[model samples]
Target chain A: MNSSLVFLIVFGVVILAVILIYNGIISRANAAQRAWANVITQERQKNKIIPHLQTITDQYQQFESGVQEKIAALRSALGGLSSEKMDTAKLAEVESATRNLVQGMHIAVENYPELKANELFGKLMREIAEQQENIGAAIRIFNQNVEAFNNGIEMFPHSLVNSLLNKKSTLHTFNDSEAEAGFDYKPNF
Target chain B: MDKASPSSENKQLATFLQSLRTQIYHAKTREDLRHVLHTVRSFGRPLCYNNTSYWLGFSMGILLGLLAILYAYWYPSSVSAPWLIGAGGLTSVIFAVLIYMRRSKVSDLSDALFKQDVYLDNNWQSVPYHGKKLAAQLSRQFSEFKRGNHSREIEWLVKGTYQGTDHQFDYHAYHFHYVDQRQVTSTIRDSKGNVRVTTRTVYDHFHRYGLYLPFRFARNIAITNSWFGGFFSSSYKPASVEFNRKFKVSASDELSAAKFLKPAVVVEIEDLGKALSGLNLEFNAASELCISFEQNICQWQRQHGLDEPDAFLQEIEGDQKLATLQKTLERIHTLMRHSDNNF
Candidate 1:
């Protein structure tokens, strides 16, 4: 075999490998954006369930749903949706309401063995706990995907096409403040 | 948002300005600021309110000038000319000067009060409409509205803020005198029974006054009061019987506009217009809601052929001015009340 032929084949194979690597990175970046959106959806669902759980807790008369302004915050957050268009203000409202409500539920049910023992109530609480756990899992998955996507955009070979894939929404959703330290900071009421 | 108070003599507004484009004067506790506007208007009788006297003065000047021209051209040379043309010239100058003097007083007074009552900077006292940035933003939102910046004289631009229990929003009262050149085509007939067509460019000055506000929405929308307005905009019908009757709201999509103009906000807007007499509000929406009405808020002495206007008056009752001001403030508050809430 000619030495030049071998070199050409090796060069062609290397180029093919680079093209596949670029495509893989692009796919990963897009997948990360979707995962981030899903995490936010989970947050919204958690917000939706919070009030119902608090109402149930209130019926038991065993714990206070530590929400200082439950009705107003919840009303503003829920009513503020204009057909899936939520401004940052509305998102903040929903986040604050949900955070407060969840915190209150946990506080009120701490020592209430009877309330916790109620089979149906126990199931509801467990469901809420599971959802809370899923929120963490979702956040972890989002952060992991974001880490991979960040590499795609920052790495030399893939950086060339990264601008095309850089969505403005990605920057907003992957706010370092929100995703850092195990998602410790939720919106404060 | 209580950044400045009316009484705090040194309420320098450089910091309160959003840019050179928008100036805001936040009254400390939100007292009735309309009294200030009323007191300013009533400071002196409206420059040309007495139509008969004004026209008579102007007509007399014209008569004098016409008489002088007649004396110069049509006077029989057989008789000694009394130089009546000079007299006519004097009359025109006197009439002009008199109008100039009164207008100057009125203009000056308005300036002084506009600065104080409206809580504006001294720099804004004579500002011509130079909201190029705002105009650009507006043009992007409403493709029909152009910023012919070549001949724009902005008289007053005030954005007032009212801090509510929860959030804060803004209402802008901005007015400008703009010049637009229009090509006019006309037909001419010659003595030889030949017809000719001619076109000439004419400059027209239009005063645009609007109470503009920004309302947050899910997306862009355009709403107007007239079909001509729809000529430049995609017509939007929310299909709510009351909304269609009261306003012509448009958007790129029907559903977005319909969803944005919630019945409750529409009611508030209607009530606001009713409260402010002579304010016929037209609606448009983008990232924010724009409640606009065409009513000149700027008072220019030169535009009125006056020298200076007054803001303080001694004899005339300010009741009418006060009433109008009250209504204006009420309307501003009503339309702008929820803007801070970002709904």
Candidate 2:
């Protein structure tokens, strides 16, 4: 082929490659954003479950003190507490306390058949379960995005741009507690 | 001759006829004749109590009307102007007195709803309650009721309970005053666990300006969280230094550390500060710096009349006071530089 014709062909190939890479990056970024949004939505939904659970427990006021203390602790931890300060030990403690509270409620329900049958109680349980699932899924998606983003930052050429934008590697992988807990188990009491 | 033979019987019959005629005449005059006519018209329906209240009310109403008319005429408008003025004044005075009495009654209802009498150390002090719930159910119900669904509010309050032995949880009762659709009057508990009273007057402060106050507030809260987290958790510690050196270091590196951290550390600090401040101000303005920050924001918003977006933006942009923020940041940067040089 003539020199001019060869140059045109190579330039066209390079443009196509760039377009493909751009699309891939855009998709990953969008997936990450969607994942974070899901996590936030799930968190809000989970927060909403507290009131309903409280109502069911109200009839058993004998358990209020213990439940109240647990609730107050959870509120302090989740409401505005920084994740940075939340070491593995503290996070585990919080998670365990929450699990225990749920277990306590399950035990309480076993004694009160009427509570278990209540429409509000049933609905609340379902919602809480769903929220937990959603949050887990969101976390997974977020981790995937974080991995991709971090990889992009570390990779040749892209790393330079990432540095200029001040983007750093984010900790999006599952924590040890999350890995140990596996999927959240539904309490049958 | 026949009449003479039964004179006693004829005389008794004549007397009975006269008595019957007199009874009919008296019935017609008394309007009892209408009752007799209606008896045939209805055939056999008995008089009912349905109209009893109506009839009694009608009579009483007529009497009142007559009395009112009589009073008005008794002191006729044609009478001297002085007399008319005196009567008018007296009537107004009476009306005012009645209104004052009614107002007190309404205030009592408001007080019961919004005031809490918390007993601590053998003394009862009045505190404001904003219907906050430790339980999730009650809080949702409170939020719903505040949104105007009163039925849910009552159901939640009646059914909601905290976990514990059912020792009468009277001390935990909260009160609320709906100052407006957005604002609330409440007493919050401070860091020292003392009650701090506050009136939160939520306006459309951001809606008009196309700003999201809640989001902004949340961002600030997040920043504070990260700051505290990093500060407390850091394994790295600097050697003991003079007060000046410590202050200088804090002003520079400590502040800049947040800026460089991944995921934007400053936002976390700002968010944490705003949230804590909001809570602190609501609970106790006397002890916490958050309350002072809130007060400053409130004053600035008020002075700038933030309801008008254009005016507010202009005020903030043109404000000389905002320069103080930049100056402070610069000073902190300078201190950090000095500390870095020393180290």
Candidate 3:
């Protein structure tokens, strides 16, 4: 009878430990998913500003035809993006394309200073800047959550529990060229 | 109401300061001293209280009087009434004399000299009659003015209009204070081995140097070194990673915040933040720009005696104070010009 009681206590402790670890992993996974949703939301918001840029830049097409064509190609490329299939690689591609679009706008503005005089153009410029800021913020938040999620499944007792019950994979963090080069710090001894 | 120009007002300040110095140095008779005190009081906020030693003396007297009474009551068989009365009476007389001497010293010319020193050091003046209206307008418009749980005060207000190269804007500068009370609970064991629990309310005072620019912004934006600025709704991270790490930017409209914080403006703000800790910048939709930072910015460290003509002259004649004022003005000008162009 005493042995049966000891067996029951150990069984209860193991079940509680597994439950706690399972809940922790699930919470981290949910947080990572929510953060990715935010990134997709910000990217879609950024896409809405492209039409405004096109309208203003179209009037100055004589000065920079190459910029206009690149912006047009970017809009179509973004149109086919599926939120469900969104990953860090696809997000990085969108980010680089957006940067190229902004660079083109800068070039167009430099070629035609008169474009800055238009009130619509000024407003559109501010909107684009805002979108760029939001996208950057969203990506950083997403990467932080992914790091947390990956850490949860890879650390000590959590790793043991994940291996036994929840076979989850580590998530990838989004990396832009600037972030990649900026964060890579190697010291010479 | 019409106001004097900054240059003209500064001239008046210089003239009045010189005359006060001369009067303080030459005063000999009590009447002459009274005249100096009157002039000092006219500048504002008079000191009417006695010194700390006087209060300490009175407190000691009260403690001794209470001890004498306690001794007599507890040891009725040992002490007599006459002895107790004599001790109490002697303590009262000593307390009265301390109060009288301290009051006389304070009422003479010491407070006047202290006030003069403060006036010169801070360049402070009495708030105008319309200052209430201005403070009220600020509380209504800016979120910073509306903060503080216990109390809020705006003092030493100075107003001037700066004529920039392309545009001109009015600025109101003041020292703002906010007080908050926090309750602290403490438990102690006394000499008799009895436990005591005491709860007291302690006050936390926050002092800020505030600059108000009565200009309109297209959108509301707040940037602060802390995440709890509580001025706006949404948080924004600009493209500058350094800025994101040091400061948190929030705005009601992200587009306007982006336009306002151009690269040049962000660099300027970062420099300012590095110079000053606890810096906060707010551009409200009410067409006002409020810049505030923790602690007093203007500091002068020279003191003069009433009879020392050289030190008095040196204090009055030095341009270090004016240079400090101009440096502050230049900083404000640079920030405003950047925001104006970008926004």
Model 2, residue B298: displacement in angstroms?
69
Candidate 3 lDDT over B228-331, as tens digits, reads 44777777765454566688888987777876765546666776788767877888887677877775665444465333444444444444344434455566
i-RMSD values for every candidate model: 18.1, 19.7, 7.8
| By DockQ: ranked, best first | 3, 2, 1
Model 1: per-residue Cα lDDT over B1-343, one tens digit each: 5643422311222221122112113322112234443433443433332234544666786787676667757766724334565566666677677657645544554454334433332112223446655665565554334535345554557665534433355556566556788889999999999999999988887665664555553445555543333422456543133334555665666665545443334555445545432333333444444444455433322121122223232211132223333355454454333222221
Poorly placed runs, candidate 3 (over 4 Å): A1-28, A53-65, A102-130, A155-167, A177-189, B1-151, B155-175, B179-343
Docking class of 2: incorrect
Which candidate number would show the highest TM-score if scored against the true structure? 3
CA RMSD of each candidate after superposition: 21.7, 27.6, 13.2
Give a tens-digit lDDT track for model 3, residues A24-103.
89977877776677677667776667676667666766645767777766676666556665467777777777778778
Model 2, stretches more than 4 Å misplaced?
A8-12, A19-23, A81-98, A110-119, A147-171, A176-189, B1-343
lDDT of 2 by residue, A1-189 (tens): 899999999999867765555554555555555445544444445467678768766866755655677666666645542333313344444455556666666765776667677777777665554445445544544565657755755776555544545454443554547545676764462
Task: Give the least accurate 10-residue stretch of model 1 chain A, judged by summed lDDT.
Answer: A168-177
Q: List the residue pairs that clash in candidate 3.
A: B215-B287, B216-B287
lDDT for each residue of candidate 2 in B1-343, tens digit (9 for 90 to 100): 4643233553443453344334333442223333323332342321111233334444554555455556667766644544544555555555555445534432432222111111111122333322333223432322211222121111111111112221111122122222223667898998999998899756431100000111111111111211212212222111111111211112123433332221211222233244333211111112111111221211111232212324323432342222322232232232222222110
Winner on TM-score between 2 and 3 is 3
